[model samples]
Target: MEYSIEDVAAARSLQFAKYMYTSMATFWTYDYACSLHEEWTFLLRSHWSKMKGLYIATRYLPFILLITNLYMSFTPNENLVKCGMLVNITSGLGMILAICADCFFIIRTYVFWNKNKILLAAIVGTYLSFVVASVSIIVDTTASAAYATIPIPDITGCYQSSTSDQIFIPFVLFSVFGLGLMILTLIRAIHSWQRNQSHLYVVLMNHNILYYACVFLFSVMNIFTSLLLQDSYQTVLDGVQFLALAIIATRMHIHLWQTNQHLRGSSGLVHIRLSDMSSVNVTA
Candidate 1:
């Protein structure tokens, strides 16, 4: 039996996706190992704050989800139903974790802008709407997915499948939402830098820029992969995007916490000058 070019391409694409996800998982695991000291010393021992829950979710939840993904990617495709369940579970959790990361960014952004209620209301409102739309679209798509074990050789995937093209809607929506956040962050970041080019302010600006840059790059990659790639199993780089953001954002908060502690009294991190912020880790 000879395989056509399309079959071969699809099989190869699926294989490549599996490899990419595995590599990403490995890289994140290694990063987690390296950050254990910081996690224990800074986040674990410190008193909790409102943002602490988000911090933990963004920081450690990936390990659990990444492990689940590895099982889905490598497991035999004997039971399509089981595979489908895994796919849906991981995808949904990944979205929620990414949502947590987004909210964490929002908190940081709001504080950076000095807790502007107007800005908070606008951004939060838009983000809430986006979340609702995203969740509905993803759930509907997952429920309606036509899961099948690809006929091509070397494409052993658990519900690692061609989902409804409508699945791309959430990815597109998220890309747009992220773009809006980027615009707001930038406009304010510029003003902040011009007003006072303090070292701490510069650090805050740099880290925020890092998060936006990562979000922009990965969001585009996710949209493209979801739309065009044949074996775009597990929505590919969405996990990568959240992982990158989690690492960057969490590290920023930790560094800022350390800096605030070192400075003794000033609220340089996001400029939140409250008595509680001095003792607790609140830089989400």
Candidate 2:
């Protein structure tokens, strides 16, 4: 069959778009790798804590997904069905990272609230409800794989495989939770500052607010692109955004830990006064 000029132009355009998307994903993934390298020592040598473990997973899992997805994008169409499974795995890893990152904020907020059991229980219940709904959506969408036609032969880019249109639900939930946490933190920070103007509280509030804003913006963009431009190259764009969110969350965790270490070291100083002669000693 002979194709028309318009058809040829459209195919070329689609091919261009695919290449552009892959380029952007590659660049961002490289940047993410650089960040992970910079923080490798802290991540490897820090006291083994649950938060540290979560940070490591949040950094590595999305990275692995990014690499796998890129490989799938460049592979032949014969393996497209396998690409669907890769997409599902990527989605699962993204969800896990999101939950872990949010849990970091939840723990921070709980500590800010002085570990109130009632508030902790309430927050946990709300978070779990969202998780259940989000997971259900993910499971339903990933159960079946969908394939897209590649404009260029031998390229295995992903198509919106899940027949479900509610793929944006989890991202929306993430934004909602983030906004709620930011508000709670803001309120607590303001109250505490009014009571006792502490520099530490100021720093904590600033860091939390900045981190929340960054992740919230990413989530919102992901939802918008997933819902509004579903027919376009949304899959690749969404993957990039998820990778970015993971990188940001992991960096925030490391920054928080380093800040706390600095604070602790500063707090360890001691001052001694001798009443006898004329000497005052201060040591850290």
lDDT of 1 by residue, 1-284 (tens): 88777666656656766787799888997987897898788865566766777778878888888887777777666678887798788878788788877776677677677778898899889888878888888788777776656566556656444566666667677778777777777888777566666666566666666777677777778777777766454355766776787788777777866665665556534344322332222332
User: Deviation in angstroms for 17 in model 1?
Assistant: 3.2
Count of clashes, each model: 0, 0
| Lowest lDDT 10-residue stretch of candidate 1 | 273-282
Question: Please, what is the TM-score per model?
Answer: 0.85, 0.79
In terms of TM-score, how similar is model 2 to the real structure?
A: 0.79
Where does model 2 exceed 4 Å of error?
1-38, 161-163, 267-284
Clashing residue pairs in candidate 1 are: none
Report lDDT (CA) for all predictions. Answer: 0.70, 0.66
Please name the candidate that would achieve the greatest lDDT relative to the true structure: 1
